[model samples]
Target: MECARKDRDLEAEQALWQRWQARRDAQTRAELFDFYAAWSRVLAGHYHARYPHPLAEYADFVGLASMGLLQAIDGFNPALGSRFKSYAEPFIKGAVLKGLACYIKDHQQTSRERLLSVAGEAEEGDDLATIVNLTVGLAFGYFLELGILDAELYDNDPASLYERENGLETLAYLVEQLTEGERRVITGHYYQQLSFVQLSEMMGVSKARVSQLHGQGLQKLRRLYEQVS
Candidate 1:
């Protein structure tokens, strides 16, 4: 009985594919997607479970997987004698990874912008200190993000994958030198993409205090760099 049900489901799927190929209409395309949508969700859930990102919600992954499923339905050649599930799995997984890569890139950009904002808020007559803090903050932020970076989290672009091999080591050393409060602020903001407000709430402090810690962290990193150089 189980085998019979499986055969029936397969036949229905094949019929839908044929109808889609014949008319190439939106209705048929959507029907095909509906048939495979559950499988796409399964793939999305699988990948999300395997590589959870702090910045990405599970729904984000599901949406990306849906896009991949649509592509698979549009491009699949049934005559090739391959199962649709097998063909679509790679497409779905690829989409999820690609989406994650974009998310990480956006987070990194936000981190830079926040660093710049913090630098701009520095008190007058601290021009030199602000510049140094901004430079070190940006550098360390990038490295911290890179340290947790995965190749699969990168778009399949080779240039995007290019990273300094020593970045992780440098980031670790600098981070180690930070005071406990500074470490919490810097790591929470850069590594987890937390906002100053979020870090403040987590640490039970004022947002201003969190920002101050972040700036002090960057200054310490700069001083450490100067000492090493």
Candidate 2:
């Protein structure tokens, strides 16, 4: 009779533990996302330090790390007796490497074409409309090739504090700091998340021309960021 009573108590304890474990798991998952949200900039800094690129673009790495963090949370096994960081470090590193591979693949193919175009047209006057059109088309085509639907790209607009704070005032300040076209392209592209194709079409320019404008805009923004720092 005593053994039976003890068995019942143990079962109750086990059930309570199971419930607590589930709750803890959920809390941990949320914490993991928050951790990644904070760590993304740090991860990007590590990447930038290791690799040379025209810009310190970190969006792709952030996206990849978020995926890794999600995977780590889902696959975490307390029973396995492995540390979370041990499992996650490799996963996050792999994600960053994959992002870098994609960046390299895109660059190798496009760089030569862009260089040739620039060399051929170095003396030619700017054709703003043509440039914008070409950029929009190319951006659209690249996104399509990557199986990213137009609807998916355009569907979401995540709110940020920066965006919330008087966009025009921010833009005016950016313009004061950046050149005319630099301000326009940055405003049109990154802030608004408009694809190159969309900007090109709206501006009545070719896709290639829009790329040049975007590149120039990025350069000016980079300089402005440096100056402020």
Candidate 3:
């Protein structure tokens, strides 16, 4: 009974969105923004917490997220068996990274060069900034070269015989080997889509410590990923 009711509710929401998308008027777009701006805030906050680029503007990310949310709402088909957050978050996150290069190019030449240069270095034995730089550079329609973030992007068929070979499947297993704090840091940061500031508050740790734990968690996932691969 509960499941059926939930399905009905989802369908109703989908129908409403479809109507809004069809209208394509300024008022409808404003309504859409009002509905989804909170999601934009969550995604922007999440990336901001993780990537505190000193020379880059954070508002660029926030604006991109709102734009992404609008795109997601306009393009989404709720019948596709994907949640709005799952479908929209990627769009939001991608826009932020791509926009970063443009923002950096105008604001800081040295930092832009530094960010681009980090792409070739291996994830291990590198600073968290390197991983972050790689993430932003490669996240737009390209595969992430590192562990957790890369693994998160590969969508595999559930029943496929080669599912075990999926990087995300492999990373999921590696996550089980992590310590509780590490698991919390990675899962909370990636899966829950929480900001480091929010995660820090939740865990009663400093924001710096949240970043440290995130880096540490990635290190462990990297080692385990190597062993399995």
Candidate 4:
């Protein structure tokens, strides 16, 4: 029964991809974004937390992520045999990062042009609850990637306070501070609840390698986790 259900879901997703690829029509493209757009928010929230803009709202991150989603829709190629999410994740993330980098640069340049000085203000506290699983990998420079099952690429502290809570209702967030390979192993082992041997097989690498990542990921999680959390 489960296998049949999985098959049906796959078929539905494939059909959606086919529709988008067929004509690249705007309406079809819109439909695609409607389905996968939440991932943009999930992925972008991580960026917002990492790169806080004193004046920017959470919605600003969503807008950037939305742009990435649109870009992914345009760049996704169905012929690759990978799931649409697999192909789109990187493009979506890349676009968001590029947008964020531009935002930071513009802000920095504008600040440089300003001759006026303002007093330093105390940082504000976050009220929203954030549910996330953080593991810093490849981007941090010390994890193993077996070329398969990679979920990312790589979050912060008081904001870390909100992240300590547990519940599906909290609206999980995504961050890519780690490399794509490292994120995959951590997600597979921890979030997916896979065993080291299982993850090793899935990733086409030795179990020892998986073990190393699990340890390193845990250390990073501790280092990056909220101190009071």
Who is ahead in TM-score, 1 or 4? 1
The sequence of per-residue lDDT tens digits that candidate 1 reaches over residues 1-229 is 9999999998999999889779887557756765776677677778889989898876567667877777788789998999889998888888788879877424553564467545654556776866786676677556555563321333556655454434445656787889888877766565444567655644667877877787788767767867874
Query: Order the candidates by TM-score, highest first — what do you get?
Result: 1, 4, 3, 2
Question: What would the TM-score be for candidate 4 when compared with the true structure?
Answer: 0.41
Candidate 4 lDDT trough over 10 residues, lowest sum: 113-122
Summing lDDT over every window of 10 consecutive residues in candidate 3, give the lowest-scoring window.
138-147
Q: Candidate 1, which segments miss by more than 4 Å at Cα? A: 104-229
Score each candidate by Cα lDDT. Answer: 0.69, 0.49, 0.60, 0.51
TM-score of 2: 0.34
Q: How many backbone clashes does candidate 3 have?
A: 0
Give each model a TM-score.
0.45, 0.34, 0.39, 0.41
lDDT score for residue 72 of model 4: 71
Worst 10 residues of 2 by lDDT: 143-152
C-alpha-based local distance difference test score of model 4: 0.51
Best by lDDT: 1
Spell out the clash pairs found in candidate 1: none
lDDT of prediction 3: 0.60
What does candidate 4's lDDT look like per residue over 57-167, in tens digits?
Answer: 455566566666666777778897667777777776676567666664234421221111111121355222211121122222212212112232223454543433331
